[model samples]
Target: MKYFFFMLAAAPLSVCCQTLVHAQVISKSTQQAIPFATVGLVKQNNGTTTDEIGSFKIQCRSIEDSIIISAVGFKTARVAVSVVLSARKIELEENLVLLEEVSISWRNKAKPTTLNDFVHCPTNYYSVGLGTYRQVAQRFLAPRASMRLQSIRLCKMAGKATFRVRVYAMDSITGMPSTDLLSKELLINSSDKNVYIDLQENIVLPDRDFFIAVEWLFISSNEFRVKAKIDRQKISYSNYAPRLSFKKLTGIPTQNNCRMLNFNGSWQKPENYDSNHVFMIAAELGSQ
Candidate 1:
């Protein structure tokens, strides 16, 4: 897993001095409107904070201005004034936990010298089936040890109105779905949705890996057309090695109601554990 820090930019204010835009920011998780979240104009200093109901009123001179909304522990969002005026509400997802920093030099030295020294040789699996629309699959591989799975985020794209997601594991060699792991369903709106799906399972030989499969259903009843993306990050420490991996998928949609996507990979560690050493692998999939 590779970790990277990102900085968000604010939106710009309008120059017309007419037409006020009222915007609301809500948490996708708690659903109890968020208060005191920061909302500001990009490239300008003008800003305001949400009130008790996670709502704010801004005076926009024109619809061309952009607005930047942010809160501690949440990912910052930038929206155009036009979008703010058109939509009655907005939701934001929480930021995934940042992986603990580890120097690269230590990891390079800790690379397993032989296949037998590898610790957690866990395999990760992911699959997507679109009803005559699209297809996708994904997987992650790593040596089992102590690790933390951070935020799992879903972003809805254009033409996609609604969708469903599930997380599960499977048998390593047979590729058969396993019910031993917990699974959850995720509902995504136009705004971002963040779900926490952390597991503390120990992966040794015989078990081989944890498989997570996501199933997506596009709601076409409302003539809804949309796409979605998934972002995941994990940090773990093994007795012999430390590793981090981040995976992201974007522009996923049902193309013909029969599309599918898949991912498969693995991680290896040395016999001796070292905290200073960290190996990272980033797996990503997105629209063309």
Candidate 2:
């Protein structure tokens, strides 16, 4: 299966349709605008993200359709379509939680270990859709002893689009992405095929499974219009560039090799997703 992605511009915008409702997302405490927040309806499989000024226009299908709004560093908010249309501003409370301190003894190890190294293969990558925060992630089992993350590496398909990197610890019970690992934003803008990102500071990786994901930023600089046929109808939409590289391999476990998409601000494993096309994202860990 192939993946395609589209980007929404960061601007005060409006949709011409009468069913579309315009709203703004803001912080409850400071009343500050929260940009790039995703607003979506799961059942309808429809959504849009807030623009630079924290404004967004989403199509309301029915009065009962629930809208889910989510952004990094904020608590997810859910409201019915009728409620969001009636209100001028949607306030999301900040989700502020201190990270647990992970202590690991670096016993003066010499070399750093690299995980998920990819072989030189044909160009194969994945993409996200329009008005969505699609995060492609790869999970790796942490070493028995905790280690420090040195850098992350990936292959860019094309263009020089800037993207964000996120780290999440694997949930013990559910085996899904759980706690946020990297608090600070890690943005990379590069056109080269091979990209390497250094953490700069030491980040402790707990002795559990962890996930590294790439988030697409829907801004003007990364936007490009593309024509595609959906349902046999040719449509034009904004495409985000610099997709992550992938390699096809056989006999991989169903759970080990799959892509996760963020719908309504939640990471979900979409059905019928290709499990053989593994993303070429790797992490380097060391005892520093």
Candidate 3:
């Protein structure tokens, strides 16, 4: 993605027949209005930039289209167009820290005994790889409470191949895994090789822990599968951690059958981690 620095100016009058919504995008920390922020209708691709006051008016063809607001040095925001038209004004809180450059090292060259052993509570572990594509999955549990899976980090394995990555989420209690709560397909190319897919869910679980899974495919071909799973364990005061596992399944490994290389471990959330919060660090692979 290209990043540009610009200031927004005054708002223009609404055009006829189009539905208009007013919005203001601001930096969460500086509290200063961000101008020239990109605000557009996701479905229709019609958008406008914020003025110097960090305010912009977007005109959409219909209420079904969603309004996506984005700015440099800020996290992207999306909301239903109908809601914005009804409310007249929407405010977005931006995340100051974007992705930082880091290095990755691979280890534990052995295969996994069982996939079940890969399941652990969610902590703060991050993984990266590349091939034809990528995928990620996570499970959060709070039997009586509800939570949201906010952001995820993904990148290509250097010197390897680049591929498309897809993500999916489901309820662990359901007998059939085909019932997906959400699914998004992504294109990872040379220009935008490393991508971060953020998930926002408002669903409430029957309890604290749930399952999340992500699968990466070779574009439209499912010749190989690279998957990740995280089991989230609830502690106290809304604090939780993840047990992380990374696996790679290749068609040629088991005579064209899928074979997995698994890494098993757990991660700990720092005392001050929040939903929009992110911590950057490096990873070193260890031999089994």
lDDT of each: 0.37, 0.68, 0.37
User: lDDT: which is higher, 1 or 2?
Assistant: 2
Per-residue lDDT over 6-62 for candidate 3, one digit per residue giving the tens place of the 0 to 100 score: 111111213332675786777666667876555656655434446667787655567
Sort every candidate by TM-score, greatest first.
2, 1, 3
* Model 3 residue 109 CA deviation in Å: 46
Winner by lDDT between candidate 3 and candidate 2: 2
Instruction: At residue 282, give the lDDT of candidate 3.
Output: 12
Task: Tell me each candidate's TM-score.
Answer: 0.29, 0.78, 0.28
Tens digits of per-residue lDDT for model 2 on 1-288? 244443333112234223677899999999999877767776554576677899987665566677888777778888887887889689998877522222223233333688887656347655655544467778886565578877777876767877777788877776678777785557566777777776666678885478888877655666666676668987676666657777767784555544365655556665655666667887878873
Residues 237-270, model 1: lDDT tens digits: 1110011122332355311211122111111221
Error of 2 at 239 (Å): 3.3
The segments of candidate 3 whose C-alpha lies over 4 angstroms from its true place after superposition are 1-16, 96-288
Candidate no. 3 TM-score = 0.28
